[model samples]
Target: MSDVSNSSRTTRKPKGEGHSRRGEILTAAERIFVEHGYEGATIRKIADEVGLSSTALYMHFPDKGAILQEICRDAFSRLIAANAAVADEDAPPVRRLRRMIDGYVDFGFAHPNAYRLIYLTRPVEAREGAQDMARELGGGLFTTLEATVADAVTAGDLKGDPSVLAQAIWATAHGVVSLMITKPYFPWADRQTLVDTMLDAMFAGLPRP
Candidate 1:
């Protein structure tokens, strides 16, 4: 037989290669899901995109739903971390609100796919399990925001009800980010311009001088 290289064929992957491979698969799946939506994405397509056979992919993820769950959980966990990192419990009310706003925007822009997957995708009954996980993942973040608003109310720095203020802030930031992502080409206004305008208007209307 002709001399041939066995080193290339016999080399073993690094110890963490398995986890890296799963991460790669998840990245590929997110791209496909964003481009094609839930129904259009398929395990076969994800496997092909990642240069894996379908059987190899299934070894990592039991099914497409499992992959989706993993992705959603990852995204939600990031949201919780991002919010918690900035919303200091002892900070002044206005400062906490500003930090929360900054954190929200940073997370959304940094992980556009994750933001869209969590905020924009329509819910399905079959995936209701992910909803519960989302609440669990995000409970801390919400609690942080709610507590800040409650503190502000108690200090008389803010006039509105805490829950209403919390909800309004969430809606305002989410609306701005969602519109920018989903309708970037819309002729209404520039993204930063609109976001800044909203922020300034929101602060301008806050309870005191």
Candidate 2:
């Protein structure tokens, strides 16, 4: 359900397609969620969209809520792995923080649908299981970022309250990804150049001890 209109959907895909109907369902659901909104999307509609019956869809995901939860869980798990690797590296705190920020941007472009579901969702629409990702996995991501910010502050390479700086950095990165995603039609600079310039400017302006 990640994107609504796919070639696979032209024919009703039987149960076995690459041994993982789960991916297709998720992709389809992403599109459905965007097109129909969460409440408007139902098991039957999602099933039809994915060329499966409601029963078949249930076999992959117990319900719509489960699908949303799995999307959130899978996304957070990937982000955590990427973040842990950067945070563990024996690099300058500022460098590690930059790399982590780059990785976050990379993730948003690489999996836009999952990114939207995990970050862009309105609280009420995402259901309780989905929000749990925020309380649990989402908190872990922020903690890692904040820890890195604290490290930089302690090293005198970055000047600001660690918590405040961490939030500001995350917000800026999110701004880049969200704006690019939601407004592709907008005229923008080359992505790499734009991101590099934005990062350079932000870090350069930050007061250092």
Candidate 3:
């Protein structure tokens, strides 16, 4: 009985331990990937970051690409959730759009490593799963922007081709976030000041009906 109990105890994992370890791996991987580009961040390095053997790390993730995919997937899910809140709000299209922009910027700032990985890194064609994630998440986000723009145009709150307007707005938001992440050393206005200035400029250029 004692032998059997010890074996059972050794084999059984404490509840949530696996999930906690995975989170730690992801956190360490993100820091490594950000500090060293994807190519430089090998599985061994990531394993070392988390104080695990490479073989043990492989038990959790098949390869570095899987880790990247998981990171992107999680980040995109959070972004979608944040945007969904604004989109679902019972507010004017213009208001919703502004809130979405704020949320997008906030997400970038909140998850700088994930943001850089998703946006700054070149697409990894080898990772089909990651590519699929990018397509699905990116497409959904863009569609929401387009639909919001269409609604605004329909309501006579703004005037422009919905597709073009949505693309422009996305590009502008991307630019703002990318610059803020990459050029932190540059002397710039306060974050909210920059966001407000950009939104005001964009709204002014976009014709109102």
Candidate 4:
């Protein structure tokens, strides 16, 4: 009986260890990717960072692109979850829009490396359909924004075509977050102040209720 119990414990331990090791590899890979960019971050480098032999790293992830896809997929999933919460709220369109922007900015700040990996990295072909995953996730978020903008337009709380307005708003938010992430050395105001200023500028000419 004791032998069986020990065998069971040994079997469970590797499963837990595998998950923990995978997570460590991902964390190390993210740091390396951020510092070196995708092309420059080699498998050997990531393995070194995680204290794993390259062969062992490959046991967990098939290739570098697979690692990147997993990182990007996780990042987009979090963003989608955050936006989905705002989308489901029973609130006025204008209020919902504001909340969504706030959430977007906060997410970017909280996960700067992930944000940079998704937005700042130059496009490269991804294995495991990473591009499709990103497009599907991103499209859902954009649809929510467009719908909110359309709602605001219908209620006379804002003006302009919903599709165009959504893109414009997205561009403005992207610019603000991109600058915050890529130009951290620049002398800048408080993050909240910058966000408020950018949002104010974007909404300046739109009709408000």
Candidate 5:
């Protein structure tokens, strides 16, 4: 009985060690994937980076595509959560829009690597699928803006299609934030000036009596 109990403990040790090693490999894969991108990243390199055999890395993730999907899904879920957090039904449309823009910019800055991978880098087929996900995510942000626009329309602060107005606001903000990320070293004369200018342009184009 004593010999059998000792043998069982030894048998379980390798299994527990394998699980921990797999977790370490996955964490290393995420770091490599972020630096090199999905296509450029290799299983062998990830294994080497993690101090594991290539076969061991494969044991955790079947292939590079599986790792890519995992990263994309994880990053996107975080982005969706960030947007959802700032969406306030009770806030006025303009205020809600402001808060959404702030949240988006902060999220993009905070997760630059993930943001670039999810939003900036993609092949044509992947791009289309990502665009679809972006639209769905946008829908969450747009719902609040649309409702706010409806309120604005009722209050006579806006006019015309609320849908169009919502898209227009999204475009304006996206342009500014995307540019900021894509051209980090851009010699814009004044960053704050540009932001203020864009806001002014947005308000100017808004419905007026």
Candidate 6:
């Protein structure tokens, strides 16, 4: 519940448990990446935050880049899986699209730290790391989204290039996530109400088929 972009020490987990230790490392690395950015987020920094030594961290991950990639892969993989489930629903494509969008926004709110680490880091190194991710999970995330958009177009419920629509829709959702996360001080409407209003307004703007 505290800020993920802070170097807060977590309670140290036991070393022998690989899964839990990996999770702790990831949780700590998320905070380190945001607090220090990619170039600054050293293995030592992450290890210290998670209560591990650099050598112990290496046993779990090769380097900070690997750590970053794993974090991004998990986040994007979960999102894509959630969207895939939405895609399978017997609802209308446009309505199913709304469900997918809802899942995306819910992720931002539920795991703001992971979201920020994936999308909002500012350093050049961080951006490059994100770009590299595009070849893997990041690319898959967009491809999945584009496929959903294309389905909507094919269903005769929306009119637009699938790629463009997908990008625009994603950018709009990202805007909501980034703004809400970065500008928590701003006076804003209720969270769900604002999200619903924004989504409704966006869906209304789509050219009807």
lDDT of each: 0.72, 0.84, 0.78, 0.77, 0.63, 0.83
TM-score of each model, paired residue for residue: 0.83, 0.91, 0.88, 0.85, 0.66, 0.90
Better candidate by lDDT, 4 or 5:
4
- Prediction 5 global C-alpha lDDT: 0.63
**Among all candidates shown, the one with the greatest lDDT:** 2
lDDT of 2 by residue, 1-209 (tens): 23557555734655457346778777777777766778887988878876777887787778898887877888899999999999999999999999999999989988887888888887888663667887799999999999999999999899889989999999999999999988999999999999998899878877788
Across residues 1-209, which tens digit of lDDT does each residue of candidate 6 receive? 22443446666676468888888888888877777678788999888887778998899998888888788778887888998899889988888898999999999998887898778766576655655765677777788778888988998889989999999999999999889987999998999999999999999998877
| Top candidate when judged by TM-score against the true structure | 2
Candidate 3 weakest lDDT stretch, 10 residues: 1-10
Q: What's model 1's TM-score?
A: 0.83
lDDT of 1 by residue, 1-209 (tens): 01112131222235567887787777777777777888788888788776677898898999887887787788777777767766646778777787788678767767777777767776772263356556767666777888888877887788777788888888888888888777768886766687788888886777652
Q: How well does model 2 score by local distance difference test?
A: 0.84
lDDT of 2 at 81: 98
Rank by TM-score, highest first: 2, 6, 3, 4, 1, 5
Better of 1 and 6 by TM-score: 6
**Number of colliding residue pairs in each model:** 0, 8, 0, 0, 0, 0
Ranking by lDDT: 2, 6, 3, 4, 1, 5
Model 4, range 94-173, lDDT digits (tens) per residue? Answer: 88988888888887888777777777776563433356666877788889889989999998898788999888888888
Cα error, residue 73 of model 1, in Å, equals 1.5
Of 4 and 6, the candidate ahead on lDDT is 6
Residue-level lDDT for 174 in candidate 5: 67
